[model samples]
Target chain A: MKKNASLTRLFWTSFSISALTFGGGYVIVSLLRKQFVDKHGWMTDDEMLDILAISQSCPGVIAVNATFMAGYRLRGAAGAAAAVIGCIIPPFGIIFGLSFFYTAVKDSPAVRGVFRGLLAGVAAVIADVVVTMTTPVIKAKKVLPIVIMFAAFVANFVFNWNPAFIILFTAALGIALQLARFFRRKMAQGTGDR
Target chain B: MKYLELFWAFFKVGLMSFGGGYAAMPLVQTQIVEELGWINMTDFTDMLAISQMTPGPISINLSTFVGARMGNLLGATAAMLGCIVPSCVIMLILTRLYRKFRTLETVQCVLAVLKPATLSMIAASGGSLFLLSVFGGEPRDLWLAGFDWRAGFDWFAAVIFAVGLVLLRIKRVKVPPVLIMLGAGVLGLVFSVLPAVNG
Candidate 1:
């Protein structure tokens, strides 16, 4: 009974977070951290970071992935199910409603004006996302990551390259760099032993 | 038939999506806006705004909007399922392995490389959307020729965008995004209704 109640809590918590937080991805991260770590004492900050890492690394929406993992950590399969449903329901319902009414209202001058204004805000938020994401790369001060980052941007913006290709190319590049470092370390060890 | 098409198109989007919600925008744009003709460029921008305003993942929000616009509730369900199923299966496997293999050197290296790349993709995605929202009604040839700089630009949007950047980035204002948008909407409506601007 205690476990079931906790699972119910997990579901509501996940749902509310998913429902309330806008701007997606990183917003979800901060909110989840606050709820699970600071608020509930369910997980440590490090655990939250780890889940975030895994969520970002995997394919699909980061919010959903992160929540599912968090729920899984707390209460296993049932927890995962509850969280995923919670996260999805609000967006689905909202978007479904908007879609239905969009055609009728879209052409209204007031609606158009609102959307136009909203577009500016959206652009600003996205800009913040870029700035926030850029800080880590700048802090790393690694030439390779910086180069990959610029290359990926150029490829998409200028050439209109497929995003999948950019991801694959960068992953392969990462693997190759690791292999080179590994072999170089081995060679240095062999010489030292001699 | 449209349901199947929505499912298939979104399925491809799911398979290709990486980096996170914003990163998925270009892929979704490609599939839905460019390839499938499910939505026009203007509608695409509007959808992005709507998705951002609402809660949850942008990718799923986009999928639901596009699917419903194309074929109603069933279409939304099909597209949403298609968008999520691949990730769901992959993540289920990953959640298990992530517990054990997260410490591996290969994983670390891959993640490190992906970091910058993902950032770049997101920057590009944001750039494209910003471009769209700001320069949306311009002619294709005019935009490509770069001659539309003064003539084609929407000055009202540009002002709002500039003000918004300052408010969020410089002032570090804590205004919720929804409110900012609502404020902009009212301003826009006022501008449009004002005879001075419209005339």
Candidate 2:
């Protein structure tokens, strides 16, 4: 009974966060961190960080991915569904409405001004996210990640290279590094046993 | 013929775009401009600008605009739906599977690698967009003397950006993004109505 209740709470919390947040996946991160990690003590900082990492690698929306992991952690399959629904419902509703009235609302001078202001804010949010995400990269002092970031930036900005290539290349790079590390550990262990 | 192709192409782009709409841009550009020949480079750029100025995700907005251009309202709907379906279905399935393997170390490590890559992709995309915002043909070509500092400054945007930065940095204030967007719209309206001054 206690577990079920907790799962219910997780569902509502996830739903509320997704429903209310406006700027999409990036903005949702801070909110999720606050609610799940700080406010509820549902997940630790390390756990939240781990979830974020997993969400990035997977093939779906980060928010949905994070919610799935979080929900599953708390309450299994049912919990995951609740969280996913929570994350998606708001965006779906908002998008549907926007789609309906988009043509009419788009041309209003007031609306234009708001978007202008919002764009700046969105830029600010993106900057904040970049800073947050870069911390680990700096700590790890992984030259490859930095190089990849810079190269990708240059390629996309200057040459207009496709991002799909960038993502695929980096994913492959990551997998190769992991395999190398695994083999190195195994070799070291074998030598010690001798 | 073209519209159906656009729908399928964008659907593929949408499915492959894991992070979000922005992440989908490079793929969309590659398919539409480089591969399909549906839209030229200049038009694609314009579509991007228009998407930015409008509400909704960049991917959806572009799909709608491009779809409309290709085959009217139905095409727009199809493209938009195509872009969204992949993420939606994927999310649904992942949500179901998430309960079983949420805590594995190997899973954790993979995620660690992906996080940086995702960040890098977003940052790269942002840099690209910044270039377009500043150096795109429209801004450069619109200049009266081919170089007017005041008009080129985009003072309104800059001021809002600066003010927002200060508010965000110092106060730790959490202002709703929608409010800021609305404020900019009002500012634009005011600027638009103001009489032009000849230097």
Candidate 3:
């Protein structure tokens, strides 16, 4: 529908973008902004960010979902196919190639040493992530969310409950809270009208 | 049979993954590592670390890595296919219902709750990996399972984690994870030579 670019070009654009970026998700989103907004002039920066928000909110790999949406926006289903295929090929190929060597070296003592170190390093990074994630909750100073956060952690870590259930349960509770708040406000407004 | 099982497990991972790449970690731990027993915790975490250095989404990289580990090229293909199908389908459904989908109050509410919830998931996964890597046991096992205390701890790993934490926690510098990991690996190599502990 938009037709700013051909299918092949879209495919290649996605492929090159997917291939080049190291850290996925946010990194890809930034590149998308540059490509679609800066290079091709296909969409405004704000428009691209809106697509990104939807892509992130949806349940999937951000890259695939974004490309699907972007491609659909551009040229419909066929465009989506081309773009996704391009985006997928590089990661699949790169990982597939690395898997062989990793399998061979994995059990070696030296590799084991590296693995241990990598684990600690990853833990540290996740720790940093923990700070990043919790700061907003701390700032909000809402007791319910703080309680929900700890409860979710306990359910998974202590009880060994599946993270999926935790997500679903918390979402349900959150929605209930939102509804209750909505009703409270509505009742308040009704009383004011009287 | 094996390929089908692998595909199904990853499919659920793709479906339940709410937030993004890191959010999928706990799902992978539950599905592939714990349920299916395709790989152990060490391999899972190790592969995750390697994927951090690679150029791809963590889910896809993990699916391909785990699949290739379980079966082969065809198996990897199947697992990947399973993973992507749900994502594509869900997105397609949203695309069709695009007008009303984004504005849905429930969607916003769920996401609001999930933001912190998923972060806890990441923290929990990180804690488990931290346990296995340094302490050689989970909190439950180390505490309730009568696991030996002194024998379970790894000093070098703890030190590496401590140092890396200090370095990584400094948010303004924007240090790359791979750099700290590689440096820690070298430090680990230095400790590996010690007679008693592998570190």
Candidate 4:
């Protein structure tokens, strides 16, 4: 009974958070920290940080991933399921409703006007993202990462390379760099033994 | 046939949804807009606007919107499934081996390069959307030598874009994104109905 009560709380909490928060990803992080860390004492600060690290590390939508992990920590598999379901309902339901009207009104001139403006706004917002995301890389002062960034821009913008192939190539390159570093450390240790 | 195509496209999107939602935007743009022709650039921008306004992951919001646009309810379900299945499966594996997973140095190495690459992808996607918004044509068309660059540009949209940029520059969350889009939409409504702006 206690467990069931907890599961239900998990569901409602996740549902409310997912329903209320916008901007996705980073937006949910602080909110989750607030609920799980500060409010409920369900998780420690360190655990929330770990969840964040793991969430960002995994290859999925960061919000879903982070919430799922956070839920699992709170309870278990059932908790994860409850939280993810809660998280998805808002997007799925809201989009499902909006899609219908969008198709209907899309051809209307009034809607077209709004859409035209929305398009420009979306572009500016994306530009803001480009600035926010790139600042960290520039701050790091790493040449290789900068070169890779430029190469990627050229590949997509100029050459129209498939993004999948670009990811694969970069991943392979990164692994090779790691391997080289590993061997160099090993050789240094070997010399130190003498 | 289209259902299968939607499934396949979003499935691939799921597989590559690394880094974050923003990184996945370009991949989704490539699959749906550039490659498959499932949606136009204008529609793509609209979808992004909707995603920004709503809650949940941008990736999921996009999948649902695209799927709903393409194939209705069943199609939306198929696309949504394709998007989440990868995350579910990957998370399952990750949860089990998480302790070992943390020790692997290679993931960080990949992320080091992947971060910049993802930034590049966002820029490319943003650039395409920007061109489509301001110039009213394919980006490829814009770059061609003989293209009518002057006539192609939409001055009304250019002004909204400037306003949006100014809104974003407010530094801190004084102006939320949804409001920014709403402000632009208001501009659109007023100007779009006007005599000169072509309703």
A1-194: candidate 4 lDDT, tens digit per residue: 12333877888877888788888777877788898777777877887888888788767778788778877776778988888888888889999999998988988888988888888988888888898889889889899999999999999888888887888798889999999999999998999963
Compared with the true structure, what per-residue lDDT tens digits does model 1 show for residues B78-108?
9988888777777788777876656788888
The candidates' DockQ values read: 0.64, 0.27, 0.67, 0.75
Best by DockQ: 4
Expressed as tens digits, the lDDT of each residue in B71-167 for candidate 2 is: 6667776776666556556645655555454665555556565556666666654443333333332322333365544443455556656565555
Question: Model 2: which residue pairs collide?
Answer: A53-B111, A112-B185, A113-B184, A113-B185, A114-B181, A114-B182, A114-B185, A118-B181
Runs of candidate 2 with Cα error greater than 4 angstroms are: A1-17, A26-53, A66-89, A105-121, A189-194, B1-113, B134-153, B171-179, B197-199
Tens-place lDDT digits, model 2, residues A1-194: 22333666877887788666655565666788898877777767877886776565556455666777777777777887777666655544444444455546655655454444444544444445466567778788887667766776666555656667766776677678788888888999989963
Q: Judged by TM-score, which candidate is best?
A: 4
Of the native A-B interface contacts, what share survives in model 4?
Answer: 0.77
Q: Which ten residues in a row have the lowest lDDT in candidate 1 chain A?
A: A1-10
Q: Please report how far candidate 1 places residue A85 from its true position, in Å.
A: 0.8
Q: In candidate 1, which residue ranges exceed 4 Å CA deviation? A: A1-6, A37-46, A190-194, B137-143
| Clash pairs, model 3 backbone | none
CAPRI-style docking class of model 1 based on DockQ = medium
Q: Which ten residues in a row have the lowest lDDT in candidate 4 chain B?
A: B135-144
In candidate 2 the C-alpha lDDT for residue B26 amounts to 62
Clashing pairs in 1: A114-B185
How do all the candidates rank in terms of TM-score, highest first? 4, 3, 1, 2
| CA lDDT, every model vs. true structure | 0.79, 0.61, 0.82, 0.83
Worst 10 residues of 2 chain A by lDDT: A90-99
**Top candidate, metric lDDT:** 4
Fnat, model by model in order, equals: 0.73, 0.29, 0.72, 0.77
